[model samples]
Target: MPSLTNQDWKDLEDSIKAAALTLGYDEAVWDGNGVLEVEGKDWEELTEEQQKAAEILGMDEDDWDEDDEGLRYEDVDWNKLLPEVKDAAINFGYTEETWEGDGEIEVEDKDWDELTDSEKAAALVLGYTEDTWED
Candidate 1:
């Protein structure tokens, strides 16, 4: 994995934390050892999408070590992982508004490709599209 800038690290942390929370974890903490410690949920009980999110974060249920307090991962491409995490979050009641705050005009004037994933999520949640947003 490439060295993460502070902001990049924060974004990745926030994304995973959000996913964990949506999937019934009470808390998600990075252990400073390339592992994320998640509390308040069992790995076997996660929904398929939630499991997918966990896998994206490098937590493989099949190889989970019962003796460890955290799950390990390496070389994670956070860009690819984020969408899956966001999808899991969305299914569990998180919305773009949850990340971007409540507003009707946030998506306005931004082209579809220029919008961040959260913005696109907001647009979709609000029933708007590339063409329809201008209506």
Candidate 2:
């Protein structure tokens, strides 16, 4: 093939890719709107124009064979999953205390008006009552 400048190579590669897509060539694909790959085809077999075009495409030299596979794009559904993912994140974040501290008071299995005076005194005996607790 003849020599090609950078811009020439770029335009040629674009033309080849457009032709490949229009011809529905299997295993022929365009990547990044500029690079084209043709399986089982040789740079020489392309018309002299093609070889020069590919060169002008500024696409660096690359090779492929019949064994080469094609690229594919797939779609996904995020609408159904996003809400559940957000909710789970919120549920995982739910907590009462945000600080790390020792000697903090925590009441469990105790209700107001249920403790007898003696139980209350026993609680105070164990330092369960705060010094400034209000009625």
Candidate 3:
């Protein structure tokens, strides 16, 4: 593959942000560094196309397979979430240092209303829903 020019990178970034908004994120902004600010979402919450854009921006490089076309949600190990996201999850009572590797954070007995807005955002990023606690 040919190397991407600066314009190519910018266009790709824009495309990813557009895709994220289309996928239900209220906002998707790149910090021009490695962080992506997606309103009410996290790495786990991102769809495959969204994640691919993140990869291009250099987040979770180890999670991607060079041989594959792109990373799929199903292929991700939830325990391997980005550091910042994981920290938020831990603070939100989603998991601990020894996560269970269930592909989702433990939320079987937690109440959604009890979780603060920030906590709820963390939970949502980890693929939890209001119905998740009920289930």
Leading candidate by TM-score? 3
Candidate 2 TM-score over all chains jointly: 0.23
Give the per-residue lDDT of model 3 (tens digit) for 37-67. Answer: 4523655766787676655544553443222
Q: What is the descending TM-score order?
A: 3, 1, 2
Candidate 2: pairs in clash:
8-56, 9-55, 9-56, 9-57, 9-58, 10-56, 10-57, 10-58
Q: Model 1, range 45-128, lDDT digits (tens) per residue?
A: 666777776665566765433332211211223233245444533543445654343544434456778877776665553334
Looking at candidate 2, what is the lDDT of residue 42? 67
Q: Estimate each model's TM-score.
A: 0.28, 0.23, 0.34
Candidate 2 regions with alpha-carbon error over 4 angstroms: 1-40, 63-68, 72-135
Best by lDDT: 3
Residue 70 in candidate 3, Cα distance off native in Å: 23
Superposing all C-alpha atoms, what RMSD in Å does each candidate have to the true structure? 15.4, 27.0, 11.8
Model 1 alpha-carbon miss at residue 59, Å:
1.3
For residues 93-130, could you state the per-residue lDDT of candidate 2 as single tens digits?
31123111222233323453454565455344222343
Candidates in order have lDDT scores of 0.45, 0.33, 0.46
